[model samples]
Target: MKEKVLILGGTEFVGKLLVETLISDQSKELYLFNRGKTNPHLFPNINKIIGDRETDDIQKIQAHKWDYIIDFSSYYPASLQRTLDHVNRDLKKYIYISTISVYDFNKYDRASSIKEDFPIVDCSPEEAIDQTMKTYGKKKAACEAVLKESSWLNSVILRPSIIFGIDDPTDRFYYWLRKIKKETKAIVPNDGTDQISLTYANDLVAIILKGISGDIQNGAYNCITHDSISFNELLETIKKSTDSNCEFYHKDNEELRAQEVFLPLNFISNLYYNNDKIKEATNLSFTTYENAITAMVDHFEKEEWKKCMIEIDDEKLIS
Candidate 1:
């Protein structure tokens, strides 16, 4: 029998790519549950259920038994609790796409990169209720808590760093991509020394599939590339990938802050991770920054890159 797979939010970026990935396998039955507001007609042949998770509409999802459940949109703990109340028993495996932001970036000294066991944000029940970007990490931590506390559920929680690729909604990575492709001069921070980790959307999808196949161990894993790169190296890679002749101007963070201009991909402190656990468990190689950026550049070239370009007002910077 073919495996049954259900994705909570399959219309956008990661979820959409995952759906595409699963569709190629003839041995899998796919179902997508979403609000029906985004690209509803993308996958015509697959099962699509329309409902809202925040209201009484979630009942649409309660009627199915899934061999694997990939939740790409669960944010609030209470909301997740509602879904768990309904499908926890029938779900063979739950894969949550969490963020590396769950690590308490401000409290810890991350000179050696963060590990899976590092402390997460401790938010009260009341605080986790809010779903703003400020509380995003705390909220995800709370959701992870719900999965960890569940006695019957076998869950794989993937905490990825910055996830970037085609169809990204946030446009964080897209900012730099467009900047390099458009402008001759780009503003950078701290002479591009601050290091950061990133997970390509396709790599993340592969890991999820591996987890579903029982090739990866259960529990939480820091899902990023095995290595981290500096901002300069990242920009250079982007430049090479896009074949752009943009010259980078390294600016001091304090000066940029004074000018109300924050450079994309510039972190206050390095946010690298120790991803040996994930690599060893999955035994899959990750895409290098050069290759990943090249792929994204190729994607943008095929479409109108300007439509998805992130607006960065160059005038706001201190020239």
Candidate 2:
């Protein structure tokens, strides 16, 4: 019998990629558990368990025994708790896609690169109750904590940095690609020395696949693929990938506010996370910045490199 793999949130970027990759694997049978609202028509032949996590609608989940549960949809501790209550105790592994925001950057010095064992954000029960953007990181931390307390669940928690690729909703990375292709003078932020770590969606999926078979270990792993890189370095990588003739200059915070400009990717000089643990564990090399950005360029090229639904007066900001 094929090993049963159930994925939660299988319609969007990373989840969609996982489903497509797993579909071809002969040793595993794939099933997706979601509300069936997003891209409802996608993967028509794959097994789908339609239900809402908020309402605890997981009867279908209880009916089946899962070999592996890849959870990309559980944003709340309660949602995860509900799923745990329904699923069987026996499983090879459970993989969860979490975020690096779970780490308390303020707790560390600016130069310290975060590690898997770094102190995670401490969340209170009252704070977790608020389901807003402000509580997102804290709530995710709570989710991981909840998983740790689950004595019967064998799990791997993957906390990735900003995930970038095709169908990217935030458009933080895509913005630079479009800016480079459209204009010659790229208005950068304060010398663009801020450090960041990005997880290419494809690379992330690659590690997820490795987790399925390799001598898998269970714990919270920082899933970032690359070392912390400078934002200016990132800008140049995008430029090289697209072969764009772009020049850049920096402007400080006050000037940016004067122009009413809001840039993406949280451009502040800070230490992102370390990826050495994940690399050693998965024995996987990540896609080069150019290759990853090239993928982005190709996907956006079909759309004629259109604005990613975010408006900015380039001329005004550059001036």
Candidate 3:
């Protein structure tokens, strides 16, 4: 029988991209679970389950026996525990969508390249249950530990850098772009020297699916492009791509830090990844940073990027 794959949080950014890729591969059956809202059209042809992970109505999830589960939405420790209990024990692979925030944010000054072995935040049991607010990274680190303890399945944990593309509503990078577009002088933090990691949506999805299909084992991997670009270079490239001649007032990292202007995009790394494993495993090369930023600018100019604009309803989650 073909492997049955279930994707939780199928409507969000990475989840939506994963569904698109899975549907194109005819060898597998795809199922999506969410709250029956958001970009519902993205998964028009797949089986869907509507359930809230927080509320614990696992009935929609318990009915199916999936060979692989791509859990893109598991955040809280309770959700992670619930997922382990609900999935079939015989599942071949359990892929978890995680973040680089699992690593220490303060360590960027020390290392140019952050490996998967980097230390993540520590969380207590109480912190895991209330995982929504400031304790997000701590909870995710705890959840990773939880899945690693499971002896039943081969768990693939992916720690991706700042993910940006057309459908991303987080406004992480777009805020800068919008500021550049509207103002005569764009203010950038840290003299644009602070190194940052960026991954295109398509590139991230490719890595996740390739890891799953190849039966990559229960270890963790950092998903990123081979190259690291400074924030100044990123903006310059975008301006060139868009033909915008706006002047940029560069501020050193210290100044930006002093002013506390949301200068740096979070979940950053110094362009770290030993893609040797992924290359040997799947021979997939990620999209280049310059090309990725250019593509993002094109999407913005074409207005195709608005798909990721966080709707007012969804904005409440972060606010």
Candidate 4:
């Protein structure tokens, strides 16, 4: 009999990619659970359980046990604890998709290089939900705390950088790609010297699947590319990839931030990760920044990236 793997929030962006990777394994039984929306027809033959996670329709999940559970859709820390409480303790591994934003980006006084053991969000919300601030990252951080405190199954927490791909809806890099598509010149923020990291969905999926079958890291790992590409380097790659003869007009960070358009452009100077431990543990080569960006551009061209963008008017699906 083949081993079994379950993925929560399986029909979404990262969950969809992870399902594809696991299905190719052939030695494992794959299962995906979601609200039966967004590409529900994509995996017709696969086992899919439908229910709303926000509510308590967890009966479908309780019926089965999996060798591994990879969560990609969880945003609330309490929700994660609920799922773990329902799962079997003998499970192989539990992989959580987290964000590098857990690190206090505002705390610039700390060292440039942060390890997996670095601090993360652990605060309670004051008033209205602030997803833009510590709400999302801090919720994820609190989820990590739950896993660490558990003794039954091994857990792997992955903090990925900005993720972009063909079906990407984040608009993280797509914003720039769209801009470059229209004009020959674009305005960049803040001297364009800050280093920003990019994590390709394919590369991240690869590592997550490999981790499930291999030894457990039993902790958090920063899932970013090996190289640190600057804002200028990113632009150049786009120019070279698209063969566009575009010129870059620059603006200061303060200006962009004041406009609120530059909030996502959170540049972490010296934003490189120590992947030696991950590489040695998994025996996998980290994806290069150039290759990662190239993949995004390739996917963008194929999808006509402009059509899939989530408009500001339909603000609900902005993630």
Candidate 5:
């Protein structure tokens, strides 16, 4: 019998890729639950359930038992709790796509890399409702807590760092790519020495499939590239991929902040993570940053160049 797979909020970004990956396998039955506000007609042959997780509409998801339920869009603790309450007993395994932001930088101060066991930001139930970027990490940590504490569910939490690929709405990674491709001069942060972690959306899909096949052990795994890259290296890779002669000028973080300009991939704290646990458990090979950049640049050049073009103001960089 084919395995029943239910994906919550599988209409965009990583969720969309996950849906596509699962549907490619004829041995798995795919079901998507979302608000249906995005690309609702993309997969006409598969099952689509329309409902809002924040409202009473979410009850539409509890009708059937699933072998695996991958949650791609549960950021708020309340919303996650509601979903868990409904599906805890009905699903055999739960996979939550979390972020490395959940790790508390302050607690791990002076540490070069973060592990799954690193301390996460502490937030109360009251504070988790804000849902802003400032509180995003704390909120995700809370959601992870909810899943772990649930008695009826066996869960796998994947903490990815800066997920990027085609159809990404955030434009965080694309911002630098576009800047390098269009401009001769680009402003970088902190002399471009800060280390950063990134994950290709397709690689994340592969890891999730491995988890579904019971090849990856259950627990929280830092889902990112096996190796982290410095910000300067990242810019060089983008420059090479775009084949652009972009000269990068390193500006102090304070200066950039004073100008009200924040560079993407430049984090306030070191964003490196140790992927030894995941590598040992899954033995999966991740895409190199250079290769991932080449893929992203190619995709943008072919399709997203026109639709997702971003204008960088030189005056803002100078001010």
Candidate 6:
């Protein structure tokens, strides 16, 4: 008997990698539930239900009893609630690809290490419906709230910090890669004190696979294993891995934005998580920063390079 698996968003980034990993396993039968808009041709042999999860179209998925429903698409609570109404939770395990953004920065006074038990940002009714990037964390918190309310849901929430890998449409991490590869001098965000945690795609997929194969406990777990990296350490890693000659200068994130310059990962507090829970549950290690950089460098192509070609007046910032 084949294990029925349905991926809510299977065409992009981490979700795409998840699909690829499952394809190798012959015991799992895969089904994709997406709008059929993104990279539709990526999976030809797999069964796909093309519909918007926000509307009644999501009902199409309820026809089958799935062994696992991996959701990467739910941003708001309403969407998740609607989808859950259609799910036969009697037999399926649910895995949510949540972000570490769910942690409220206001809860901390400085760079502090947080765990799954930490207080998440509260989502207002207005913020729940809005789709702007500003309300993203709150809305995700709202979705998590829905999961918490559903006491019967056999769900495992995996909150990952800044995800970095190949085929990443979001040019956050790739922005640094481009700067290191092309430019000589660049202005990095803030002083070198701010530390950030990142999750490599391969390691994240391994934890998700562990949940799928084994009986994972129902709760949220921070998916990153590495301790943390400071702002200077991040740039040095990128430079060392690529052997680039880029000179980095210091500038506050707000200062750069005031000059009409937008940089990625303008984080306020430290993103380090106490990952002892995940570490104890699964004996999985992570990709070293150097090796993860190599993977991204190897996969960066003409399109990705073209994305890096944005005209940023680094000289103005440097001066």
Model 4's TM-score against the true structure: 0.87
Backbone clash numbers for all candidates listed: 0, 0, 5, 1, 0, 0
Q: Which model is ahead, 4 or 6, in terms of lDDT? A: 6
Per-residue alpha-carbon lDDT of candidate 1 for residues 1-319, written as tens digits (9 for 90 to 100)? 9888889999889899989888989888999988999998899999988898887777777788788889998998888888888884866799998988888877677567688998888878777887577888899999999999988898999998888888788888998998899788888786788877788899999999897887876699999864888888889989988889988888888988887776665653476689989998999999888888888888888876865345666634625
Q: What TM-score would you give candidate 5 relative to the actual structure?
A: 0.93
Candidate 1 lDDT for residue 164 = 87
Name model 6 segments beyond 4 Å from true. 301-304, 309-311
lDDT of each: 0.84, 0.83, 0.72, 0.71, 0.82, 0.84
Candidates, ranked, lDDT:
6, 1, 2, 5, 3, 4
Root-mean-square deviation (CA) per prediction: 1.7, 1.7, 5.0, 4.6, 1.9, 1.9
Q: Please provide, for model 6 over 1-319, each residue's C-alpha lDDT reduced to its tens digit, 9 standing for 90 to 100.
A: 9999999999998889999999989999999999999998898988899999989999999999999989999998999999999899685689988888898877765555788898899999999999899999899888988998998888899998888888677777888888888789988778867888888888888888989986578899988757788878888988887789999888887877778787775564475688888877787777888888877876774345666534577887787
Worst 10 residues of 3 by lDDT: 310-319
TM-score of 1: 0.94
| Per-residue C-alpha lDDT of model 2 across residues 1-319, encoded as one tens digit per residue | 9999999888988999889888989999899989988889999999988988777587678888889889998788887888789888998888988898898877888566778888889888887778788888899999998899998888899998888888677788788888888878777777788777778899889988887774558898888887767879988888888888988878886778776777777543466677888888888889988778787788788888876666566676666
Tens digits of per-residue lDDT for model 4, 131-245 = 5653767777777777888888698888888776655656767666665664566776667777876677877888887777866477888887555677788778777767777
Clashing pairs in 3: 167-308, 190-252, 190-253, 191-251, 191-252
What does candidate 3's lDDT look like per residue over 37-143, in tens digits?
78767667688888887677665688988888888887887778877888888888888988777887665555456667777789888888783668878888988
lDDT of 5 by residue, 202-298 (tens): 8998888888887775689998864777888889989988999988887898977877776665664466688888888778888888888898888
